[model samples]
Target: MSKLKIGLIGANGRMGKAIIQVLAQSQKSSLSSATVKAGSVYIGFDSGIHSGIKETGVIFDSDLVAACKGSDVLIDFSSHTGFSENLSIAVAEKKPIVIGTTGLTEAEKMEIQTASTQIPIVFSPNMSVGVNLLFKLTEIAAKVLQEDFDVEVLDIHHRHKKDAPSGTAQHLKEVLLRAFDRKEENVIYGRHGMYPERDPKEIAIHTMRAGEVIGDHTVFFLSPEERIEISHKAQDRKTFAVGAVKAAEFLSDKSKGLYNMFDVLGI
Candidate 1:
């Protein structure tokens, strides 16, 4: 197979740089276009140099269409900001895309769903292979332990990270809900002053932001007799970066639809 050309959105951000470095080392892919947010310092510069790799002549631009026009797939790490416009451009250009953005509103998520009918989209909140495995495991555990144990989710990330509760935590909550046939009302976000005794139907979620920790998540299943904990710790951003590139490869030349990490790893 010929090398796949990949375009990157938010190519000046931390995740963007990591993806670029991973692609630089990968044998099956190469950067075709790199787009930064408007007025970025990296604009007009070689994306390779900004990503700490040798120059590859892919200049960082602000035009999303121009970027997508030059590639077979686009990997987006640029959170919700400017996402709608980028998605529109990708759809108009009929290019496959891998979206790793988090903290999207319900309406934005609906937009992705609508666009998926027109273009192939690999949409995932957490792209780490281990984390996706945790998702599957969490579902299995939830199914087996249904209604017998109280469940809770806890997540910690770098202070610089935005989005409370974290996307991975939310995904885990969804898994538990689906496995147990519960509803969104069952989720309780971080306990605070003067709350009543925990309800059996509630799945409590807690989030912490401190230091430079990459990411850590723990799911607790507590019973009167004992406790079971399942956790995944991300030591670095490279895990996510590498998985996203692999997702791009998985999405290449595929049919139009919305796919998740499960589709990529076949879990």
Candidate 2:
């Protein structure tokens, strides 16, 4: 059987390099092309060597259109700044895309939702399989606990991560809100002095960025009887890379739809 050809966008970032390494070792998919920002110094370099791996013959370039046209699927780990263009190219070429970009605004996400109607798209903040499971578990716990428990979320990542309350944390907040059938008004970022009291419907998300932590998230459910905590901590970026490749593979045969890791994992 022939391996799936993968065109990667944002081939110079941290996740980009990790995905390149994953494609090098993958049995079901291979890197066909990689794209970097325009005028990037690494533009003409071999994608594999630039990613710290042996030569794979795929060179980094700045042509999103060509890359999208030449591959069976596209995996985008690019910054949110270029996400719309990436999605547009994929849609125009009619190629399925797996999006791993984070820190997207609501407007940007609506663009993805609109684009999904034209091509298959798997968009997720964190593509780690374990993290998706954490999402499901959090939903279940929130449903079972209901209003009896006060819920809070903790997000921790590397100090270099610019976005506070990592996208995963935001997704967790959404999950909790969905399970509780609450609105955004019930969610709080963090506690401050002089608060009257905590609302049972309130969900808090706290963020900490320090050191070189990959990612860590914990959902706390506290009540008078007992406490239940659901957590998923990423030890390496490879977990997300592997999941992104898996998402690409899942979209390879599809035509049009919007999906997430849950759809890929069938959880």
- lDDT (0 to 1) per candidate: 0.91, 0.93
For candidate 1, give the lDDT: 0.91
Q: Give, for candidate 1, the lowest lDDT window spanning 10 residues.
A: 190-199
| Winning model by lDDT | 2
Top candidate (TM-score): 2
Position 88, candidate 2: lDDT: 85
Candidate 2's residue-wise lDDT over 108-219, tens digit each?
A: 9999999999999999989999999999999998898898999999999999998888999999999998999999999999877889688889999999999999999999
Residue-wise C-alpha lDDT for candidate 1, range 1-267, written one tens digit per residue: 789999999888889999989998899999999998888888899988987889988899998888877899999999688899999999999999999989998899999999999999999989999999889889889999988899999999999998997889999999998998889998889887898888888998999999998999998999999899999999989999999999999999698999998999987
Candidate 1: stretches off by over 4 Å: none
RMSD of each: 1.1, 0.9
**Superposition error at 160 for model 1 (Å):** 0.7
